[model samples]
Target: MTVMRRTGWFTKSIAAAGLLLMAGQASAALWSITYPRPLSENDLRSEYPVALLTLALEKTGVKYSLLPSDRILLQGKALRQLKENREVNVVWSMTDAQREKDLLPIRIPIAKGLIGWRVFLTTKDQLKYFKAVSSTDQLMKMTPVQGEEWPDTKILQANGFNVYTVPEYPQAFSILQSGRARLFPRSVIEVLNELESDDLPADIVLEPKLALHYPTAMYFFVNKGNATLARLIETGLERALEDGSFDALFRSTYQETLDKLDLENRTVFELDNPSLPPATPVNTPDYWLRPTRQE
Candidate 1:
């Protein structure tokens, strides 16, 4: 599906105008939040978080509107909203020590650890190239492309993999398609849908038998000063979990994708996330999606 794109300057102007208009409306909601746009052309994963968050908020009986935010320059730029106290109230990302300290995190794995499983995007011809490989050592020999500011790029480099870093999201796929990089790793929930939605050239295909595993989770982050919003999210998410709505939504939204991926038949290479925060609830079984192993 096509996602309408607006430049950051225009987006901020719209947001300012929207707030002004919202203030004058008698029926205006109690809460307003913004979401990031698709990272790739015609992709719609950007709206996935919106749906989950909306359901959670609805459970709290609080009226809210999820708007599209300005394009972000850095993944952590949203965290700066807390310090600068901007209007961008809620954002989500992989957790890190500095991020947890800077923003209020709900501490639940919103995607059920789906962000940690990676499926690589590569050219069709490279299917044979990958088939010839047998181990992480061989895969590491192939260059991977990632966003310049993404923490995953740093994690890959730290693990001794050669990575091509670009400053923007679209450039990573372009670089991979142009053969400058052999692979672009994306989450399991992301890769298949992106390929389907992007209308990408026929040359691009998902590497069928490889999956990368790491320790990470996407958490809903709120500004540190916005304690009310934080409590609303925490309470709402807890209710969803206790009522099994979270798991039901998870299966409904992603079970088909996981089934299509046939994860059990793939080679699961576990990678070390040295960047994972110490405060992460690694031992909390109820807080994560542990489909592959015993907790």
Candidate 2:
């Protein structure tokens, strides 16, 4: 009876040791995730998104090593790499029909819908022109410029605005300097940071009192078959939302942005995005930031 008891105890000890080893291995399996590298040293707009991604991963208790791609690839190239699962595993962009078809979206708006809230970057010469604009019709009279491949160009065109397709991104600002394009509509977060950079020509300024608003989501997308990571990030984001950490992070990062733009008092010109995926959670009242617009 004593030997039988000793054998049972040894078996239990061995099982416990194996369980510990498995747990240790699980903890050590680091998820090496790659994101797009910054285009320039002054490109600080990625700070909040990267920080938010870090916060979500921390909430999941998953050992992750978030790193940028080795090369500075454009948004289009980086997205292609993500689709191929080659250099990048993740990317954040506005959800449209084509993108939704190619990648698996986490379906959570990383920017809380601020991705669609646009504020114009104008030149001093166009200041008086915008100041008199009281409605979307009046605003559409001026030529608006956007990236050739950006969904905003289509949205603007569909809404009856004569939009110019910029040949290259860097030249978009120069277009404003040359007085060819009157407005370059940028997201509220993006415009603020770009204005802070010394690279912007002195003639550029933020247009006040008028904002172009739309309902859209910027979602993190992975390879179509990479459902595991999609689930992991979505789960982490949901957990953060449940505990209010997500709200905390957004408010802390963007409170100043709202204050600077004076969004509450601006007259909003709401537009429809024809390319938005039908699966977007635009109807989920709790999933977005519905700011109180003056219009």
Any idea how many clashes model 1 has?
0
Least well predicted 10-residue stretch by lDDT in candidate 1 = 19-28
- For residues 1-295, what per-residue lDDT tens digits would candidate 2 score against the true structure? 0001125888989855754664465467888888999878888878887888888888777798999889997777877888888898989887788888888988888888998999999898888888789988899899998988777888899999988777566789998888889999999878888998877899899998889888788888899988767766776787888899999999988889988898888888899988988788766665789666433
Query: Candidate 2 has which clashing residue pairs, if any?
Result: none
lDDT of 1 at 151: 69
Please give the CA lDDT of all the candidate structures.
0.76, 0.82
* Whole-model alpha-carbon lDDT for candidate 1: 0.76
TM-score (C-alpha) between model 2 and the true structure: 0.88
Instruction: Write the residue-wise lDDT of candidate 1 on 203-254 in tens digits.
Output: 7889998888889888888877876677667767777888988888888888
**TM-score of every candidate:** 0.83, 0.88
